[model samples]
Target: MKKVLIVGAHGATAQIVTARLLAETDDQLVLYLRQSRRLAQYADNARVTLVDGDVSDIEKLTAAMAGVDVVYSNIGGVDLGTQTKHLLTAMQQAHQTRLIFMSALGAHHEVPGKFGDWNEQAIHDFLPGFREAAQLLATSKLDYTEVRPAWLTNTDEIDYETTTLADGFKGTEVSRASVADFMIKVIADPSLYRRESIGLDKPGTDGDQPSWL
Candidate 1:
């Protein structure tokens, strides 16, 4: 079974990813989060190994990466750029390369039209760090796929399409299941979106803004 390291394992999307991994594959999981107690439900799960540490704690992070086949990093916040660098350092020390990073849709100013304007205005503060994290992965030697999901939703459906770094992002929102599905697919086949910044969105959902608003 493959050993998977999931940073920010307590996130909503990461929760879905981990659940699927547990039920769908025989993979072993190293759940790394700032607060380990958050995943107390998985304490009895033989396949799950929870570790408490920040990404900036390179020593702990590096140790957690031992024998991991792939890393799924679902983290954010103002200091995300710095966190990404720390993760890279730890991964390097562990001699692992494959990474599937969770990013936001407007990360590279890649969204278009009114929806783009809305998205930009909504999260302008976090864009710089997201852009920086994306750029860091783009230039790094690691085999990475920066997952930029178009506004997220708790919808149970797993329906979505993708756009590359060269293409403009589409749709207003995509379900967390859809984003997690894509990540699981990548885990099953690392060569799928090699070294790409992919935008995930539900087809035909494009609009000036998410329907909820």
Candidate 2:
């Protein structure tokens, strides 16, 4: 079975991914988070091994990288760029090549509508870090798939559509559960998407795409 490491595994989206992974795969699971308290909810899950630490800390991340076959990073903040850089460095040193990262739409380019406007603002405020992070991942030797979802909702539905760098999807919004499902899919089939960023949203929606574009 594949051994997988999930960074930011305690977040809402990450929690779904964690549950699905345990239920669906025999893969050994490792969860890395900044706070040990956040992982308390998962203490009883036999499939999950927890590591409490910061993803941006090289030494800590490197230690977590050991014995891990794939790294699924859900870690995100205003300083996404720096955190991504640190992850890339740790993966390089560990020689772990499979990676799946969560990013928002309109990260590098703009979406088409009002939601797009919001996304653009987020990018303006956060893209420097996100762009740099993407650059670091792109330049790395690791096989990667970056999943960018539009506005996130709490719906548990799995209906969604995925596009790769296409335009005009300005009002699309995807449920966080759907995003988690997609992440799990990428982890299972790394060959399906590699070194590419993809856009995700609900299958049918209206008006100025979701904020992520």
Candidate 3:
């Protein structure tokens, strides 16, 4: 069975992805989180091996990468660039490939659609890190797929679409559940592997900006 390590596995999206993997696949899952208490709710999931550690710590991250077939990173922050750098270094040291990174929609340039201003600001502020992370992933021999979602909602729906960077989708938002589903789908099908990044959004949704944006 494939061994998958999910960073930020305590987050909402990670939790859903964990559940789906446990139910649908025979793969082993290693849930990596900074705080062990965050996984209390899932204490009974025998298929899950919880590791309390920080993604930015190379030693800890490398330990978590042992025998991992797929690494799904959903960790984000203002200092995400630093985090990604460490992650890349650890993965490289471990000689592990197959990565799925969850990044924001406006990671490259500013789009004038929904959440444009805030997203632009965020990208501008964090672009250096995001770009660096993308560069490391793109240059690596690893099979990587960067999934960028517009606004994230907590709705319990699985309706969404994947679009290229030039799709010019305006004000599109997707549920966290859908994002998790998309991650699982891509992981299950190696053919879906795309080195390029893609945008995700809910169908028929307007106002693409997230409240926090």
Candidate 4:
């Protein structure tokens, strides 16, 4: 069984993935997040280990990387670039190479038409760090899959479409559950989508912007 390290395990999507892993696989989990107590329900679970720390803490991150086979990052913020850098450093030092990261759809400006323009104007502030993180991963030697999810929704269903970096992104919104499902797939099968970027969106939900807006 793969020992998976889920950074930012406190987040919504991460939590979904964590539950799915426990119910579906025999994998061991190391759930790392700042407020570890928030996920106290899993504290007694034999398959789960809670780690209270930030990804920026290289020392703790590297220490937690012990015996980890795959690292799935579900955190994003203004300091994403710095966090990504630290994660890469820790992984390298620990001799870990596989990573599954959640990036933005516009990180590479791969979205098309007016929707793309609207997206750029909407979340412009968050793009730089995501873009920078993407570039850093592109240059790194690790086997990483950058998931660029479209506008997010709280929907419980897992319905989505995917596009590559070379193709234009599709749809306007994708459920967090969908993204979580895809990440679980990668964690279960590391060879799937190795060293590529994937754009995730709900099929037929295309528009000038997300439906919620």
**Taking the candidates one at a time, how many backbone clashes does each contain?**
0, 9, 1, 0
Which runs in model 2 stand beyond 4 Å of their true positions?
A: 166-170, 209-213
By TM-score, is 1 or 2 better? 1
lDDT comparing candidate 2 with the true structure: 0.81
Task: Check candidate 1 and list the clashing pairs.
Answer: none
Identify the superior model by lDDT, candidate 2 or candidate 3: 2
Per-residue CA lDDT of model 3 for 67-175, tens digit only, reads: 9888999888778878888888888898887889988777666356545766766557776666667667777777889887877889889989877766654555789
Which stretches of model 3 miss by more than 4 angstroms?
121-128, 207-213
lDDT of 1 by residue, 106-135 (tens): 889989999999989999899999999988
Off by over 4 Å in 4: none
User: Per-residue lDDT for 1-213 in model 4, tens only?
Assistant: 999999998889999999999999999999999999999999899999899998889999999999999999987998889999999999999999999998988999899999999998888899999999999999999999999999999998999988998888999999999999999999999999989999999999989988877
Is 3 or 4 the stronger prediction by lDDT?
A: 4
Model 2 lDDT per residue over 46-150, tens place: 777888889767888888889987899998888898888888888888878889988877766746657677667755777677677777877778798988887
Candidate 3: Cα lDDT at 142: 73
lDDT ranking, high to low:
1, 4, 2, 3
TM-score each candidate.
0.98, 0.90, 0.88, 0.98
Residue clash pairs of candidate 3: 171-208
The root-mean-square deviation over C-alpha atoms between each candidate and the true structure, in angstroms, is: 0.8, 2.5, 2.5, 0.8
